[model samples]
Target chain A: MKPFEDVGARAVMILSPGDNIAVAVRDIAAGEKVELDGRAVVITAPVLTGHKIAARPIASGERVIKYGAPIGKATAAVAPGETVHLHNLTSDYLPTYTLDEGHEFLKEQHQ
Target chain B: MTIQAYLRNDGRKGIRNIVAVTYLVECAHHVAREITYPNRDSGAHLIGFPGCFPNAYSFKMLERLCTHPNVGAVLLVSLGCEGFDKGRLLEAIRASGRPAKLLVIQDAGGTRSSVAEGQAWVSQTLAQLQNTPRVEMAIDELVVGTICGGSDATSGLTANPAMGRAFDFLVERNATCIFEETGELIGMEHWMAERAQNPALGREIVNTVAKAAKYYAIYGHASIGPGNADGGLTTIEEKSLGAYAKSGQSVISGIIKPGDVPVAGGLYLLDVVPDGEARFGFPNISDNAEIAELIACGSHLTLFSTGRGSVVGSALAPVIKVCANPDTYKRMAGDMDVDAGRILEGRATLDDVGREIYDLILRVANGEPTKSEALGHQEFILTYKSFEPLGPACFPSAA
Candidate 1:
């Protein structure tokens, strides 16, 4: 059987079918070659571990897919073999509370 | 493996027989802590609510904790004039056929004398607990809860799925498994409901998640922590998909609010975010708060999975820490029990780590110390909140 790492983010992982990105398991320097689906693509930027790599080309405002579902929307045009993160994509859902805000909110309520 | 257990009146079995020192309000906290801290070597731990304001949720959580199967006795400390319901709490503990006592600080001659009196009583109760009868405890009678903390990309990819596989094993053996934090289960509510034994139970799952969403929105926030984004999670939906894997593939039998016990053994979801307004702030201030709720609901032991690393155990129940990231495990090996990160490294498969967790539960119940227990990591917390009792639709299997 193929090792589970090949399917996981050891090098890269596609979480679900028809998804737009794969997670980088290790940091790959630019100009290096990485496998995607069946073919090889040369890295355009230094991709960090745990960051997303574009599975295909997409236009701005397009939904970014991970785990086969929309995690967020692209803020700018993302090309294949590029990294996906806060610098490119943004969260569709806002955070419920921050660490500092929670402290303040708790203080106000109890006081 | 069969475990020699402590039988309870409710037909539940306890793995640890502990004496709990409870402070009814914050004013009595110092004296209560002093009474318990030194004797903690003999199985004492401090747990209580600090709020002087009366809260039905805190009251119920206190009742559940004092009567928990893991707790063999309790010492109640109260500073008079607080809004907490001390008498009702004492009655519940006594009703459970365990030793329980209440000391009002003002009547007991203030903090110094009261500490002396509380110490004597704790000593007496602990001696009595040594006589509690031990019978046979088996896997089928076990109730387990899984929680994810400091989650990161590795959490969903490795540790959570491993936990899910272990959960599947427990459910098959007729054990009750509980997975919670509906706030984190934001995007996959419909998928979760479809796995419920009955259709109405599914709808309850949907409603509870919505309650979490609405509750968080009012507070101008979401459940995903900062560590989550630092580890590459971008949205609540992405974090949720990772969080939901802990339940495995069992058909959910019930949905419960905090402090509500299960009627039968199967998979259950705890609806933690409260009903009504977001006045109490965040539903769970930290991971320990959720762990406390699980102990209050009769969990014999808890499975804690973390990606960024968490070192917390609990006051009444043993907590097993499952580490998700290989790198994190290497850094905090002493604090973790199982390295589920082996799944992603290909050193092990999901089943390998899953079986490892299942084995750890049996060994811990039979008196083997988990990494948390051995390291003396018993942490506890409870806060004020409100809730309406979960409805019949939430527990259709019991009907």
Candidate 2:
């Protein structure tokens, strides 16, 4: 296996070729421009390291691809460089469990 | 490569000769804990099933654990009135040709006396274990298991895949490698099935993951938790892909449930989810439960990958913690054995960290203490579960 540096020197990584999202290898600040493929994609929001960023615009209800497979569906239209997380992307399987502001168990269901 | 190991009468080898102080029910836990406290640094580990009611799964798990290769001897602590079958468990332990003793807290004059007697037995057993025969144990004689917990996205990108690389190395050497947590592999079934040794085994693999999915669905929760979401894992499918990377690229040789030891050396997938209806609350209550299941299946040691950072180690087996997130690694360096996050930082390649893990496994097998072991993290947990016998396709390669 080649070193990760051989892939690219970008702050974000596209795990697989067909993946429409890139994972932040480092914490990326909002409005920071990072190159994906040959084009520059501006970060719309601050993305933490190990979080996902939209590589390209994704339509609502479209499958969100990662690890070369569909991880879930986009809950709403997503712009390039947007953070793809529980707020915008929902699991196609069971609901993701979370806590409400009051620390009560909240089952976040897919839209 | 070979390391000096304790050879059991059953022909299995062990890296540690641990004297297990086990309680049969929740009532006896305190007495058992007291018995093992003085010998905390001497390999006398406290492990038990807390359920007062009888469960066949817990009984089998305890039996397998008592006779596990790593365990040198066992001391059973029972409350006398509890429903756990202490007699059968003691008999099974003695039948394995290991020193076994039982302390009935009621008949032995309750808590104080039971604790005293149990401690005496533990002290004696630890001494006797020193005489266990040392033999040359090769890599093929090893049974290694992998599980990912407290996972983040870097877990898949770094530690999980690095562990996968290490698993591939061990499998290539003809060692037994087991990766589990079917619930975490919900969406990767088809991808995993394609790597099975046979079409039938492939089908069985698919069905196993389906069972996990159904079980989790019944509880209205995927295995993904708030901690997982906090670490940026959105869906169970996304987490599944990350968790699945720990299996490496080996052709999955078989599927075995808890306490079902693989008959031969190869890569195996441990089916941890219960078989029947979703009577159990969750497949595994926590990561330690899964670690206990792996130990019951005869793993000499376990590879634990984490990005969010977990400090747990097992009673019978040594856990090599691979920190996946670079920031987490920085925060929890003392708790981790391998910093797989170096791959993410471009400081090391996957192969580099993979080799580091593989080398550490050998060193740990040769009697080197892992970070957790040195820190006294012998955490163990077991609970109720039911499983039907494995279908023939589950272990086609096993004799």
Q: Pick the candidate with the highest lDDT.
A: 2
In model 2, state the lDDT of residue B334.
Answer: 98
Residue A64 error for model 1, in Å? 2.2
| Decoy 2 TM-score against native | 0.97
- lDDT of candidate 2 at residue B165, scale 0 to 100: 90
- Clash count, candidate 1: 5
lDDT of 2 by residue, B244-271 (tens): 8899898999999999998788899999
> Ten residues in a row with the worst lDDT in model 1 chain B?
B4-13
Q: Estimate the overall C-alpha local distance difference test score of candidate 2.
A: 0.89
Name the DockQ score for candidate 2. 0.56
- Please compute the TM-score of chain B alone for each predicted structure, in the order given: 0.98, 0.99
User: A36-75 in candidate 1: lDDT tens per residue?
Assistant: 8777989988875566889889789999987766777889
lDDT digits (tens) for residues B236-309 of candidate 1: 88888788888898899999989998868899999889888777789999999999998877788999899899
All candidates: TM-score: 0.94, 0.97
> What's the lDDT for residue B41 in model 1?
66
TM-score attained by model 1:
0.94
